[model samples]
Target: MDYEAGTYQKLPIKQYPARELGETAEGRYWRRFLSPATAKQAGAVNYLEFCPVRPYNLAVTSSTRVLVYDGATRSLHRTINRFKDKAYSASWRADGKLLVAGGQDGIVQLFDVGSRSLLRQFKAHKRPVHVARFDPGRMHVLSGGDDATVRWWDVSEGKQVSRWEGHSDYVRAAAVNPAAHGTWATGGYDHVCKVWDARSAQSVLSVDHGAPIEAVAFFPSGSVLVTAGGTQVRVWDLFGGGRELACLSNHQKTVTCVTVSPNAGPDSSAAPRLLTGALDGHLKASVREGVYELERFQVTHIQKYPGPILSLGLSGDAGLLAVGLADGTLTVRKHAKPRADPAKAGILVGRRSRRAPALTAATYRYFIRGQSSKAAAKDSVIAAERKAALATHDKFLRKFRYRDALDAALSTRRAEVVASVVEELAARGGLSSALSSRDAAGLGPLLDHMRRNINDPRHAPQLAALAHRLLDVYGGSEALTGMLPALTLLLERVELELRAQDGLTRVQGMLGPLLAASVGAC
Candidate 1:
């Protein structure tokens, strides 16, 4: 377990895999997970949150762009071109289509899903709106900021309707309880988690944490409130008549934010999930037992990573996790395996002692059959399938032994797999039914592979069909690529098409590809 501060041990989790836990199991895992790698020197990741929508959820990156990825398919749909600023906080409305985000600039803007237009702009707070959340109760929107006030915005008229200025310092986080409609809560550097009756803008309850509370939220039932920061997560039991229920300590650095599992609704048996993002560079999810009892063998499960995760959001099915780090990196991580058998893994039993992996083959065998259950085995099967596809792709290059390492890794089958991944991504937006999503605005990585096919008019008929389809979705015609040939042809085709046409004006610019490495003597 040789883990140290500021470094994450990329543990070998044969997650699906008795398969590809990592291409190099210990240091790297998926190729794309490391594609948008962080700089050696990282930045301060301010916030991380997720939309409550289904498969594809929106996450905010430091580049100020909002990235959407599908939890089920493990692919991304590029919308980095949509939000053109440094976003502080982003959230989806209860219905999932309308998205609202704010930043240090002190203005909060709402985008309508159907029109993609700014429906309204309201100045809810003056000192840079830090966070804004829509009340699931359909009452009002709650927002907090450096101004030290939590304001309630009237959703119908687009104006500030009420405000509660209580804390002496800046507000860092906020949450709304769905069960307790017309109610919400806030956490701040003031070292307090305050519950407010959203209907009245009045502070109803306040709990003091020993450190600044970086994140806060009420559990699904509104009976308990959880807040975390400085390596501890404190749960307030309002159900216990305002008693402190439990405190969890595992994070190596300051805990950034904690989100409950989307599927942990009233009737679910799976434990309540508490995901913690850390300034120490990792994100881990721990389930709550409600009564402070650990299960059979080793109850706590953790996944380590190599970035300062500032934010985390759970997909609607709780099947996927989106982690946003300070490095301007957005990673869509698969959720950890289900709880391990406590009776199988020897219990520490009331003591925080070391946890050991079974040593004997008999022990390993006992653990393996269970540890690598149908789910774990399922991961292996997926990895094997992907590996075989990759091998088939490289077969031609290896027989001739060209030695061009790049060609050895990038193969035709791999390219086709990328297309399938893209289609899966576009399917989330219901884009797979048409040619538009399959061609552009599909999976970002998959789209990269298709760019080489742009010139073939033989590919042209499909490209034209795809372009025309995209025009129908986007309602305009502009080449996603900057090349003169493509742009010229796209414009002319748009005019000639008897049916409607739509397209991108140009491919969106990348954040840092053109920049030289930094020299650090300042």
Candidate 2:
């Protein structure tokens, strides 16, 4: 669980016998939950939302039903199937007591979340209703539809309160400003995002987004708005003359949905993130920044899906992100935050506590002088000792003293030293004498070294010679029986390599004559 800041642990790129790299903390943190739970819907999912209240239940709209799920456990809680046609959007009232959904039947239905019963139904649009959401006060609900109108309905009376009809095409996205009462925003296929007020009969402000708007959301501060459509996500300042702030083009396909993290606040360490899902099956999060006239937004995190992403939902605490794909796959992933380290925490607190005394040149020089002299002296002594020992070992081998050379090489356990000694002994025809003993102890190390290098084409011949001698000397001893399996496997691998080499040589000989004839013709 120990994580160092600014350090990225890389995952393996290919299969191996070691533990999977995905088992690391950073890997597990960003990994998908269990295999995606398949939603048994007959049609593609259109929208998903998590309740704003405690327990944070989830709602998914697909076909003619709105399915409710336990947010924490990801289990189906209930289903509302009263819609006569496909349902498009599902949203929750601020109090968490009511659930509302717009349907292809051109009607908006409200249900009691606790009782799971239809509480109110109102005919709102003449065509398919694409979106519905509750106002900030929960006293009225707004619904936008394919009829190209955004209408407000008084929830207490279950009657239409007002309607706006500026959009030339389907009205697909809408959101109410929680910080500013009776203020809201809507986006449509007409490629415009309009801010509205209940006190006015006309839109108070409008911004052209350059493409059909599929989804829109207001920053928690109610001072900015984000509109997503086509391949871009644009942020507009609501309070600053309605100027365009930043444009993000991270998605490769149409952005189908967008949501803001509920836990995002002005004092947060980083900007509250805007999560967008696209038709290309990518879900990405981008940090929201302050007013910058021509800044470009960058994606901070991305999660890929198996099908086009149709809906996205973020839990209130920002702990979970739920994605609904067009193929009816519901995947929920937990946010991975960097773990806190006590050492780092202590250092940070200490730095802010009080200033340390500044260093003077005299003290600095005195500290360096004492430490450097001792370190230099120790390093020289160790280096000279190592050089002397190596010289003595080489002298024994040069004298053709096979036992002394082999013993020195074995004690060091250095591959280069052992290989050189074995090669020399084999060339001088002293290999059998070097291994001629039933001591078994010395023979074991030699056999082990040979087994380790036997398959390497460069060392195969020398190792093979040494292995053959050891087998002849100690092949019948009980002590050597335990190592036979390893020795047999090693020899088989070397034989396979030798046969493959011989086959390749034959192939080259046959091709050389044909290549020469073709070259001469050319």
TM-score of 1: 0.53
Each candidate structure's count of clashing pairs: 14, 0
Q: What tens-digit string does per-residue lDDT give for candidate 2 at 1-77? A: 32332242221122224334435332333453345555556678889998898678888898888888887677888
lDDT of 1 by residue, 456-518 (tens): 333434444545554455454343442334445555554554233222212223323322221
Runs of candidate 2 exceeding 4 Å displacement: 1-38, 264-268, 289-294, 335-522
Top-scoring candidate (lDDT): 2
Cα lDDT listed for each candidate: 0.59, 0.77
